[model samples]
Target: MGNEKDSLRAKLSPMSYHVTQENGTEPPFRNEYWDEERDGIYVDVISGKPLFSSLDKYDAGCGWPSFTKPIELEEIEELEDRSHLMVRTEVRSKKGEAHLGHVFNDGPKEAGGLRYCINSAALKFVSIEELEKEGYGQYKKLFS
Candidate 1:
């Protein structure tokens, strides 16, 4: 556990370590991807596993990067969260188990009505143009 923490600390920035490992939240609107308007795929920062695609991203007015859903349902695990004095469903990467953020029922009604509010610190975006070079060519289909 110590070795993993050490490795993670070395790989991730302080804010990323706090958000992904410590379950800390970054300030809204000031976050990296909160206002990102690019075409790409969002992968787990630690494990590099595909999580969300820019095709599903939308401005939910929550100051965080919001997605209608993951690239694949199997890529994430939603758990009941009782922290912060409010019951919510927590989103985490299946492989990395990084704390992504929460999912709420207040998303666009036409988009399945689920808001996956994610932390930018937990993800690394691979632009559509750089997908192949980033070894994420498979996700290019989302852009097409």
Candidate 2:
């Protein structure tokens, strides 16, 4: 983990470092991807592991990017967070262990009744056009 942190420190921006490494949250509407409507996949910034897809994204009026579900359940790790005197589920990337964000129960029920309120700093977006070249060719079918 130390080596990974060292490498990530050199690659990530200050805001990314704070969000992903220090478990900090970016301001809701001011962050990236909150209103992104493009077709793509969101991956962990550090590990480049797929986390969410555009197909699962929706507007939750929370000022942050929200996904109904992840691309793969195994790609994320959910832990019980009791910070700020509140109980919440903290979502982290399984491989990178980056602090993605929290999950809430107040999502559209038809979509699964769960909202993965993720931080954009913890993720990198890969548009449909770049899926193949980015070694995510297998996921291209999802877009099709």
Candidate 3:
């Protein structure tokens, strides 16, 4: 397991390693997926575990890829973050233990009252058409 994690860390880009391993934040608007609109599922870059879906994505005007919820509640693990002198809930990928981003209470009321402001470096988007080929065929039913 340790070797696998080391291999995964080595394969990640610098920004991705920083975000997921070191809890670093990427510049908001400049990051990928913040403005993406295509239908797809976002998975953990390290573990390939499904995290979010385009169906749950929304523009929160926060300059990040915001979602109402995870693809499945079990895929995420929340931890209390006291970094930078602010109390926040940190959301991480359960399987990969990658720090995805933070969750806030403010979000579209109709969709849900929580906003998962995720880091693009921690995720890889898999389009609906590519789900099967990418070994995520079971998730295709989400689009169907």
**TM value for model 2:** 0.96
Q: Write the per-residue lDDT of candidate 1 for residues 1-144, one digit (tens) a residue.
A: 999999999999999999999999999999899999989999999999999999999999999999998998998999999998999999999999899999999999999999999999999988988999999998887777
Error of 1 at 48 (Å): 0.3
- lDDT string, candidate 2, 1-144, tens digits: 799778888999888999999999999999889999999999999999999999999999999899999999998999999999999999999998789999999988999899999999999999999999999889899987
Candidate 1's displacement at residue 80, Å, is: 0.6
Model 2 steric clash total: 0
Q: Which lDDT tens digits does candidate 3 get at residues 1-144?
A: 889768867899989999998898999999999999999999999989999999999999988899999998998999999999999999999998899999999988887799999999999999998999999999888887
lDDT of each: 0.94, 0.93, 0.93
Candidate achieving the largest TM-score = 1
Off by over 4 Å in 3: 1-6
User: Per-residue lDDT for 120 in model 2?
Assistant: 90
lDDT of 1: 0.94
In the predicted model 3, the residue pairs found to clash are: none
**What TM-scores do the predictions have?**
0.98, 0.96, 0.94
Which runs of model 1 end up more than 4 angstroms from their true locations? none
Give the TM-score (vs. native) of candidate 3: 0.94
